[model samples]
Target chain A: MSGTSAPATAHGPHHAGPYNPAKGRLGMWLFICTEVLLFGGLFLLYAVYRYRYAEAFHAASGLLDRLFGTANTIVLITSSLTVVLAIFEFERGKPTRARNYLLFTLLCGLAFLVIKSFEWGAKFEHGLYPNAPHLMSMGFGEILYFGLYFTMTGLHAIHVIVGMSVLFVAWRRIGKGTLMRTRPAFLENGGLFWHLVDVIWIFLFPLFYLIS
Target chain B: MAETAAHAGAYGEGPYFNPETVKPGPAGWLTTTNHKRIGVMYLSLIATFFSVAVILGLLMRIELMYPGQQIMSAKVFNAMFTLHGVIQIFLVVIPGIPTIFGNFSLPTLIGANDMAFPKLNLFTFYLFVAGAALAIGSCFTGGGAPDTGWTFYVPFSLKTAVNVPLATFAVFVLGMSSILTGVNIVSTVHTLRAPGMDFGKMPLSVWGLYSTAWVQILATPIIGITMLLIVVERIFGIGVFDPTKGGDPLLYQHLFWIYSHPAVYIMILPAMGIMSDLFPVFSRKNIFGYKMIAFSSLAIASVGSLVWGHHMYVNGQSDTAGIIFSLLTFLVAVPSAIKVVNWLATMYKGSIRVEAPFLYALSFVWLFTIGGLTGMFLGGLSTDVPLHDTYFVVGHFHYIIFGGTGFGIFAALYYWFPKLTGRMYEKRFAIVAWLTTFVGFNVFYFPYFVMGWQGMPRRYFDFPAKFTELQVVSSIGSYIMVIGIAMIIGNLLRGAKKGEKAPDNPWQGATLDWSLPSPAPLENWDVPPTVTRGPYEFNHSEDDK
Candidate 1:
């Protein structure tokens, strides 16, 4: 088996040139699986504490502003749609349209983070910050509830920032005409990540805000 | 041999010896994306950590040579044992086989050029280094070294002012590295196989690494989040684990063991795969039950995850939970037994080679059986309650981890030395090392079983006068084992530079790796090979039998 063709590089031509859409999708999906497990651990904690302190968890959930939570949920779901549209535009060979859609997706991500920070700030104003002096006066379950809330949402917000940055990079590449329809794996992977961030928010919104 | 040479030189100036093709110079090695280079780098890093950890262990054993402290204070002893456990578990054993042999051999064994994500492979290597540096650096930073053991169990972990945050964060970084490597390997195994190399047709070692990658991906995240929670608790006084904050300490045990129990399989499975590959080759036979061995790896991964509760039996978990976990722990042993039986059966009527590698593999069977059978004793509710924190538990753990996986690693190192360096290690030195190590390993750990059974607790700086004899025996054994380990490392180092050149197929094995040059080229195959038979097809060749 010698000298039949040029040697394949480490990333392999399957990924590097004329993207094998499937490999990119598979890698991203595998990454998404790890992300699920990451959040799954937090969910496990939530489930355990909620079971033990159902009343306190319910009371804590009621204290969270459902309107802001619902609004942020809508913002994230809308971003997921925009990112999907970005992929759709790229697939349709409209580079300019895809770039605009990506920009919109990034804006939606920013809006969600801004709203989330405001929500956290409101909780801090009400003395519900994790381990704050006021939380020590709250029941053990409530302390745990707020603890899980800040940790989980805080981690989710980090993902939103990361997802936004990935989209921003893709947006820049698209503008350079380098990430056109033919080379859309970068954009597709970015979309997949953004959608993952949105999906996690869907769960977080219900568990922390609407469960009660 | 001549025919082998023809195929070996078919790819000119092999990657192992050719500086240009393999990226010459220290800088090239630092930045290279070649999986083999990265694998060598991992082996070097692991070796360094293993040596340091082993020295710490020797010191600990010396401290326990008599009853009272021999060389260090109780505080120093505590930190020494803690750092030793942390380094050995996280840096050395857990990442040992997969990163070293898996990165080097998986592609070649499957007839591919390199891992699916080579740059990511290099990235994981650096992450491991950074994590290790952070862990080592914590010793020099605030409040002295972390005295909390590697498990970092509840209230103690939370209360310790010693740099628990830095140590825990180091583990978090290391866990992320493991997860990324897992993703890369799973993707590689799924997509990078040579044409006609179906899952069944892949070598058992690849199967081992593939199963292990899943464990790493699924189980590691729990630890990641757990460690983060600990960090949060430390910084914010969250009472998730601290009893003062209305947190249940048991929750920490539950979450820690969830990842760590399966982490045991993560440490052993790839090594198990190595034995699967070795047994057939040395026995000069096709593997007796290929499907059995292959499926057992996956079986162990799945079943092992559920047995995490076994570790919490004495922690006052519910009776039903304890019974269920004990049963699951027993269930995991079935798959392990299936693998051992298959290995022995593979050797049943074959012309077995008694080489250094095979000796280690054989020692693995004997030692692992001892390790596994003793594990059953601990899996039982009645037996574990009494032996839980005793020297018996420590003995059983060392037997399985060090004797089982550690020996498996030694076997792999010797077996692949020729392929890795294009030179044969001195066989006599290898055998002597194996003998001393085997004898020393048993001497070092076996008495712990007796002492433990006789009511000696573990992790203590001093023992009563009654426990002194066995402790001295174990300590002396450790010194012998250290010498043996040094010989093995020295032999390999010397072999790389001065030993005889190895042929492509030194052992006459029938795997794809043996089809290439002794040191495989940068991109493994000149043209990717299309598989025509399974990894072990010895029955078709008279010489192989």
Candidate 2:
């Protein structure tokens, strides 16, 4: 790392190109580290409530549809693969193929969101969301479980949308040929982020749906 | 870019202020990627917020003068202290040493031209400004400033009519700035060191920031999420921590302390690093137990995180958890004690300079020791039962934060002044200011330790008539301390533009920074330097000077 990185400083200030794509990996990984902890915080909250109200959490988990959870999991995981393939193709000098792969990633993102909203809507129609009339009508443990359920999933959905937006931009820029091998950090980082969003859903799927 | 015509040195090398800026004045400042200018920008912002907090503190002191509605109503007093805490913690201290000195010197110390992410560095500064503006704006916007205290303990924070969502959101913004800065600095150190400068040979100040950057990266996110939750609870009516909705209020505390405890190390570790650098220069000797002092920084950062439960001891953490936390808390003291001992050992049997920075360093050793010893009292569950929220806790806090980190900052300013400006402040005024601040500080805060032990609770707008004498003394001391601070700041500001040119190699330091121009070159060096030995090898630098 030192051998490779120190040369930028050695180049002196005027010509020292500090924005090499490799350094972007360090920055993006650090950012991804923070994102994991951001969700890690909610995970902690879930763990605490899960410990305190194991039976109630199990009961509440039954309310969420395993079929929708399974479908969204497949869509999100497939989206991550497409993002990686997009980057893979871009690195291989196949911009056209990369754009196609990124387009698929965005489509998968949309499908996952559509599936997630349907799942949420089914619960909402039954008044099972946080502070809902029916959820409040249930036991305190159930209220706690569904409260965490919506918060975690709601937060995850927001990340999915953000990831799709990033990839969408990358797809357009790739089509425009603005990205180059020397500085493809933008798409590379976007792919890492898309993977994280998918990975978080992977955790969310089993934690909520499989618990039942 | 050529607007300044203020080349840095005799050879007319780099631009004096900013290298990439296209405009002269404020526009140049706003777009600058120069770490020195960014450091100055942070200084300017911190000075503004510190004054506001100090004034709020003095007003609180005035209200406590005779204890019975001396100046303000109880409700107003609550708002004042809350504002003070919010401004001081998020605005002034959390971004304290590392933002100011680390930005200014870290690149130069490691012989890099600038931070690895210079544009991102400027972005963080602007982000900090926006966050600070949001925090300041919250004082007037919704229901007036929040009165739920800085901790913003849940249920109350949820229930408060005062504007908490805006304050929490402001904190969230500030946390984003802190996290990005951590990313930038960590990358700067990892990738931008001089040719031969490995981790071991790097200055303790860099190590201090390196350790602190990790803490900032790891711990700050937790606070960011927690603060976001506060905003979420208020805006979305989430019952995540509302006890009436089956949520536990204790969870709020657990989450708050998780980040906040590590934050104390964030505040002090850099200040400790400044001392590690200062002791070697003043004493003209190799730093004693250099590796121990360096590793202690990392040790302190690690152990500091585990002890957050200690803050919750009286708040009803289980006895087992409290015991575990208490033991971990004591473990932190070991590394801290190692640092203090090593500092004194470095000064032993050497030719000591006793300059302004060294004087402050000496003061830091004793005052911080007092703060640390008193912390031992509060860390124990048995003794803490009495002192948890009393004036004693308040006194102990002021000693550690104000006496310790605050003095550490003053010492650094004095030490770095010549290097930053190519000039020197009046030594006589510096001495006088330190004396007044020291005497006034002791007189001001010492009474709180005594009054608190006698059972005077903190944050009270009124107190018993029997405690009148101590309160009067404290208020008087606050006045003196404020005057002293003004003098110290006045002297430095005066020195920057008008003081005599800095003597060639004033401190005779061995680090790479000391080898550079007094107000160092804009890019620090045309070619990055090569390191050959440890940071404190003063044996060789004497002849070079």
Model 2 C-alpha lDDT per residue in residues B1-545, reported as the tens digit of each score? 01011222421253356444335778777888878888889999998999999999999998899957777889999999999999988888889887898798888788777787888889999899999999989989999999988899999999989999999999989999999888988888888787778888888988888889889999998998899888877876567798888888999899899999999988888899998999988998889998998899999999998999988898877999999999999999999999999999998997998788888898888889988988999999899998889999889878888888899999999998877788899988899988898888888999999999999998888999999999999999999999999999999999987999896468888887777767665666655566778888877664334
In order, the first chain's TM-score in every candidate is: 0.90, 0.93
Best by lDDT: 1
What residue runs in model 2 are displaced by over 4 Å at the alpha carbon? A1-9, A15-20, B1-15, B18-22, B542-545
Q: Interface RMSD in Å per candidate, to 1 decimal?
A: 7.0, 2.7
On residues B1-545, what C-alpha lDDT tens digit does candidate 1 reach at each position? 11233234446345654677655788778998777888999999999999999999999999999988689999999899999999999999999998999888888887777787777888999999999999999898979899988999989988887999989999999999999888888877776777667788888999999999999999998898899889988887767777776678898898899999999999999999999999999998889889989999999999999899998888989999999999999999999999999999999998888999999999999999999999999999999988998999899989999998999999999999888998899998899999999999999999999999998988899989988888899999999999999989999999999999988678887778887777766666544566667888876532353
- Candidate 1 lands at a TM-score of 0.96
TM-score of 2: 0.96
For model 2, residues A1-212, the per-residue Cα lDDT tens digits are: 34245445444455334566667788889989999998888899889988988888899888888999999988888888888888889998889999999999999999988988898889989988777888888877798888778888888999989988988888888877787856789998999998899889889889999885
Off by over 4 Å in 1: A1-19, B1-13, B539-545
RMSD of every candidate to native, in Å, equals 3.3, 3.1
